[model samples]
Target: MIEAIIHGVILAFGLILPLGVQNVFVFNQGAIQPTFLRAVPVVITAAVCDTLLILLAVLGVSLFILTFAWLKTVLFGIGFFFLVYMGWVIWRSEPLKVNEAEATSFSPKKQILFAASVSLFNPHAILDTIGVIGTNSLGYSGEEKWVFTLATIIVSWIWFMGLALAGRSLGKLDSGGGLMKRINRFSALVIWGVAVYMLTKI
Candidate 1:
């Protein structure tokens, strides 16, 4: 069980280390939100999406879904356009000011929808969770499998919250708005780059 836990943590962390669209959006929300508590919805939504994917993968439901080629193509098409749109929005977003009366804010509904889009629509995320995590789970069974699943889920939740907090800390440091603007631009580029990469894959 200890080995399973360790394996789960290491594997999950490794898979999540990449600066994917989901992580970038979560970090952006954390940085732009007025308060950490206000950012909780985004964090929770992302974590829940990942948890569902992981659960589906581990239980083998993802295998059935993956059998259909059209589904993958559809997901990729949706994801590509969504990423492009999100990147454009981020690129054009004005630097949020602490005292600005019209500072932009994402409502809970928008946050949930965006979080789900990034988590569920991205072919890379789906494949990673289902392909990597599911294949790995095949090595364990019974108590070990449960332990492994729990560990991976816990890691995901912790990682998302940690990312939000880290972004919040950076946001605090960039009170002047200059650094924040640059960060926003860079985030947009990264997102668009992911979209282009997805296009190539499809």
Candidate 2:
């Protein structure tokens, strides 16, 4: 069981280490958004998705997602197109134009929904959760598999939550909007680069 948990953590770390589209988007949001509070939903959604895919893998259902070459190809195409579109949107998006008046009326729910959509539909996330984490579950037994899956989910939550919260704490150095815009632009480029890498891999 201990070995299985360790294996799951290591696998989770490896998958999360890559600069996926979600990482770029979340980091961008953290830098540009008024409050770090906006990122909680994104973290939760990502973590839940990770757990679901891991469970499917443990149940031996993920093999079908991989075995169908035509399906994989189709998903790959759809995902690639969407990623490119999203990357363009993120790149072209205006940076940190938050109106203080509007900020007072801002809804956390809307931000969460946005975060959820971004995390859930992300192409790299689909592959990582359904392909890497899902397939890796086969190495463990019943309880060990459970432990492994939970640990994987924990990694997602911790990393994303940290990013979201960290942005708030770090916002101090950049009191002016100028620094935030630079960070947003930099993160957008990172996202664009990652999206392209994913497309080529597919």
Clashes of each: 0, 0
Q: What TM-score should be assigned to candidate 1?
A: 0.95
How would you encode candidate 1's per-residue C-alpha lDDT over 87-198 as one tens digit per residue? 8888988766666534465777878888898899887788998888998999999999989999999999999999999988888887777887898899899889989988
- lDDT on C-alpha atoms for all candidate structures: 0.87, 0.64
Candidate 2 Cα misplacement greater than 4 A, ranges: 97-123, 197-202
Per-candidate RMSD, Å: 1.4, 3.3
Candidate 1: residue 19 lDDT (0-100) = 88
TM-scores, in order shown?
0.95, 0.79
Best-fitting candidate, measured by lDDT? Answer: 1
Q: Tell me the RMSD of model 1 versus the true structure.
A: 1.4
Cα-based lDDT at residue 137, candidate 1: 95
Local error of candidate 2 at residue 201 (angstroms)? 5.7
Number of the top-ranking candidate, with TM-score as the measure: 1
lDDT (Cα, 0-100) at 139 in candidate 2: 74
